[model samples]
Target: MKKLLIVSLGIIVFILLSLPWVLILVGRNKLHDYDIPQREQLIPSSDSKKKVLALFPHPDDEVTVAGTLMRLKEDGHEVVLVCLTRGEKGKSSGIQDEQELARLRTSEMEESARLIGVDQLIISDYPDSGIEDLGMDSLKKVVLNLILEKQPDILISYDSNVGLYGHPDHRLTGKAIEKVFLKEKGKEGFSPDRLFQVTLCKKQVEVALKLSSGFQRNYPENPEMGLPQPDFSVRTQPYFDRILQVMQAHQTQQNVLKDLMPFHDKVPAWIYSRIFDREYFREVK
Candidate 1:
């Protein structure tokens, strides 16, 4: 009886400790790719000078499309990065005050933008993590003004319908851009030719979250987290180093990433090299 009891306790401990990985395996079993037709592969001509505009909610959020933006710039296209907020509400590395944190984040963003080869970086005054609280009409106006000023050929942002983790700021930023996009699209000589929403694959999210830590609140293991079906997926294997450098520039968010990612510095080059190589995008309009 004593031996049996000991064995039971050991089994229970083992099961409890492995529960997270078990859940990850279960979630991954449900992964399935959609049978969507492939869109034309984008190959920019070296002389083509397409103007691209990218809108994101925070300083670090730009990392989502860093590789794409870098490729566009290298191909002779101009790219502009419009950050909605300074990431004042983000987890702090060492700063105590929100204003100081915002300042540091802005500096980091500038450095990242320069290195990523963006032509311009625009910073908005909206409160960090408070985008949805603002009136939609007002947000639309702000985005519209920028779109009118820039006259970009392509616009990229997060998908409002299905955010990576349903972040309110990300959803709201996408919503505002959608409204402005539709409004300007019908206007004469004004709308962008294409609009793309950066997204993640279901299988990729499942495996990544399994390896990550401290993401329960942000990236719950919900089916809605991934794009229903991606319209296009860009392979960015060649630009992995560029994207990593861009993410590293957000010094204040380094600790936060490390907490979420299993690798030291929150990003192991080999792991992300495989995971982020394929970037998904849905062309909404």
Candidate 2:
């Protein structure tokens, strides 16, 4: 009787100790996947030719952030695109092989650029699906060089952490961008301080969470691990449409997308109106 009681007590204690972790795990699982259900309002900008540079970790990131860029270009910003990786590991519909997929995505980006009126497209041969592996020193070297060469009035990239379980490439690029900026800011000279990036806001986080919950219902990959929610957002409708078009360009990830987003017909207009836009640096005068 004593041993049984002792064992039961031990088990109860252990369960009690793990209660917090279990609750956290369950809460996170509820938001395993999601998509942006809305669009942000485009803030007004000067109609002059403002220089802008966008650094993205993969082909689709550029497309993902497409709507806001569209607004910037429409506002007369001179836009430049820098793709950090070829996203060779990414899939495409109709295209069966890796080589073809890469080619198709590149072409798709070209189409995206044409639609958005981006003035320049630059790509680094960093391994596809391998941006998270970028070495700090190497990234710093490359980013610094690009900063000098582009001389952009504004620099944009992934926020420190994307609200959803972030893509490794996106997180790495975000960290690398901050490192590069910190290393270059106000130093002897690397042109003027025209660096900025788009960020996810709190309202956006709420939306992303709701969307992710829906996604989890379809594909229960890993129980979700919730991160910081968004607090800032930008709106770009036309760009959001373009982003959808770009996503459509990638057919293989249909399963992933299916899990992460709502059917187009079911998505609400208010969600569209409140879409999360890119977060970036403030334009230096």
Best TM-score among the predictions, by candidate number: 1
Q: After superposition, how far is residue 43 of candidate 1 from its true place, in Å?
A: 5.5
lDDT of 2 at 176: 79
Off by over 4 Å in 2: 1-48, 92-96, 162-164, 192-194, 206-231, 238-240, 251-261, 265-285
On a 0 to 100 scale, what is the lDDT of residue 184 in model 1?
A: 75
**TM agreement with the true structure for every prediction:** 0.78, 0.67
**How many backbone clashes does every candidate have?**
0, 27
Query: Each model's RMSD to truth, in Å?
Result: 8.4, 14.1
162-270 per-residue lDDT for model 2 (tens digits)? 4133666666676677777776777765753554455443443455556664323432243244333333335554455666665566555554454334454355433
Q: Write candidate 1's Cα lDDT for 1-285 as tens digits.
A: 999999999999999888755654453343324453322233346435788999998998877777777778777787889998999988658677999999999999999998798999999888997887788988888888888899898899988765655677887788788777876786786858778888766665665566645344566455644444577676666787877788788889987655433353444565446544556788875
The CA lDDT of each predicted structure is 0.74, 0.59
lDDT minimum window of 10 residues, candidate 2: 276-285
Number of the top lDDT candidate: 1
For residue 191, model 2's alpha carbon misses the true position, in angstroms, by 2.9
Q: Candidate 1 — which residues are off by over 4 angstroms? A: 1-47, 208-215, 219-226, 258-272
Q: Model 1 reaches what TM-score against the true structure? A: 0.78
